[model samples]
Target: MSSWFEERRADKVADAEEQRRTRAFEAELRREERRKDRDEERADKAQARRDKALRKQARAARREKTLTPGNVYRKGTLLLVAMSALAAIPAQVAYFVKKSLMLLPVPFALEGAAWVMAAGVAYADERKLPAWVRWLLRAFCLSAAGFAARINYIHGSEQGALVGWGLAAVTMLGPLYFEVRQWVITLSAAISNPRQQAEERARRKHDRRRRRHHRDVAKVADRLVSAAPYGTLKPEEAWARAWAIVHGTTEPGMTPRMHAWAVKSAAALATAQQPLPLDSKTIRTRIEGRLHASAFVLPTASGTPLGMTKSAQVVTDLPPASKTREKTPVKPARRQPPAHRRSKGDALPFHPIAKTVAADTARKVTAVNGHH
Candidate 1:
């Protein structure tokens, strides 16, 4: 019985040991699988890096092949692009050199060289240059002139300095003078442009109507004076009243000087014609009495006045004195602020001459009514 128990225990121990060894073998297999996966991942990464480098090199080679001068006709645009970049190299070099120089901060030496290079870029038969290059050259040339002016001001007498600076300026900017000479030609062409001439002609055509209208207005004024009866006032005063009656308002748009001109023109024409036999003083006195009786309504020109009104009538056609008279209730005049209350720059309520004229007219009117 003891031997049977011992054999069972030994069998159990061997089975347990076998299970532990199987677990260790599986763990080893899993570790080997993980290592293989890591190696594959690393190899793939290395291959991808090599492929990327190869692609970059190939692209660079293709770019270089396209830029070769022999293939210029085949890659015309590409060649131009390459040349444009090459053209820029000089300016960039100059700028760096200018920056490196501690003696001059203004960079005039590089600027002059750049200006000359600009002309080469402009007129060179090498069709590789772009339109933008012309503008870049122009900017460089403009700055070069300022440097030349500065050199002239500071060291014009130094032939050595002049030669060095001036040579750079000549190389860069000398050709720009040719472009400047075109200004006179361009201006002349603009002045003589067919389109501009046509516009000027159209403008002149419109002026004719304005001139005719002015002439017609002057004629109307002269006719008014000729029709008017003689009065106590001067010919100029009588004409002014007649003009107001004919036009209804003062001459439209006429300056004071222009109004004076129209009056003189009308008076000249009227004096040349026949005069009426009416007594001037008696006519004036009657006109004054009638004026006091009612408010006067100046007549407007009959038939198409300034093309604004279709039908009009003369002042004589106004309603009779008794019929036109109004018994309107008087409203109080606007009360003006007293002189002491007025602001510093305020105008007076009445002008001195106007006050005197009102007083004289009132006295005359009172005397006339008494006589009547």
Candidate 2:
């Protein structure tokens, strides 16, 4: 009985030890398999990276080969694209550089450049630009001009833009007109047949009618001048009546000089009793009488409320108001207050004539220095 119990205990101990050993071996095998998986993954990633690098190198080499001068003909489209980009690059750089130097907005300057470039391309290739391009560029230019012109006209300021645009139109359109005349002659030659001649004559007639319609605008100047009450007024008063007449209905995007002309025409006719807007002859006569007693509206072009300066408009940062106390710009020693007594009870020490002379002198000096 003792031997049988001993044998059974030994057998149980051996079985338990075997089971522990088996479990340890299985865990070790799993660890080895996991390590192999990590190594394989690392190897695969390195291989992929090498392959990608090689592919990139191959692509770069291919591009370089195709872009060589000898290969240019085979890559005509690419050549044009590159040329276009190259053409645009200088303008792009110039625009941004100008903006950085406080010249113009980058976007606006670039857009202007794009427009010029487009025009150049069309002219060089001898292709008429798409209508949309012209329309878009015109829209951009007009929008900028309209806002600036409106504000400048209303404020009766902007020495440059007003003058610049007017002068520019004169200079540019002068040559353009002659060229157009030549072009017209060429075009007319192509249509010398009787039927075509008739069409041309009708077109000319239509153009004439349109121009006449615009030209026959009321001579406001005559009305204001002859309106007796306003017409006979002092310069200040006359100017007011003239201004009122101009403002009443003359904002048809014409020059202020044109506005003055219209006012003068209207005034000349007014004494003969033309009906004014919303006012009876009696009311008009009364206002004119009052105006005549005071200063005549001196028909100064820039003196008009909505007058555009016919000069080159320069970009300047004007203060909101120049009413604050400031130091003397030249002397730098005098502290100028609001009530600066340059003249008796005149408020400020600002002399427009003096400033203008100084500015002109300075400009001339600078120009002379540049020549030197």
Each candidate's lDDT (Cα)? 0.54, 0.50
Global CA lDDT computed for model 2 = 0.50
lDDT of 1 by residue, 1-372 (tens): 999999999999999999999999999999999999999999999999999999999999998897676355435533443453344334334444555756353444544454465555546324545768756766666566455444433342345765445444443343344334333333444577788788988877755664466555545545655676654345445445555665555654555677789999999999888665445454556555754554323323454222111221212223334655458976875995453543454322333443555565666566656743
RMSD of 2: 42.6
Question: Per-residue CA lDDT of candidate 2, range 346-369, in tens?
Answer: 222323443554465556556545
Model 1's C-alpha root-mean-square deviation from the true structure amounts to 32.8
Task: lDDT for model 1, please.
Answer: 0.54
Q: lDDT (0-100) at residue 358 of candidate 2?
A: 49
User: Which residue runs does candidate 2 get wrong by more than 4 Å?
Assistant: 73-372
User: What 10-residue stretch in candidate 2 is worst by lDDT?
Assistant: 307-316
TM-score per prediction, in order, is 0.22, 0.21
Model 2 vs. true fold: TM: 0.21
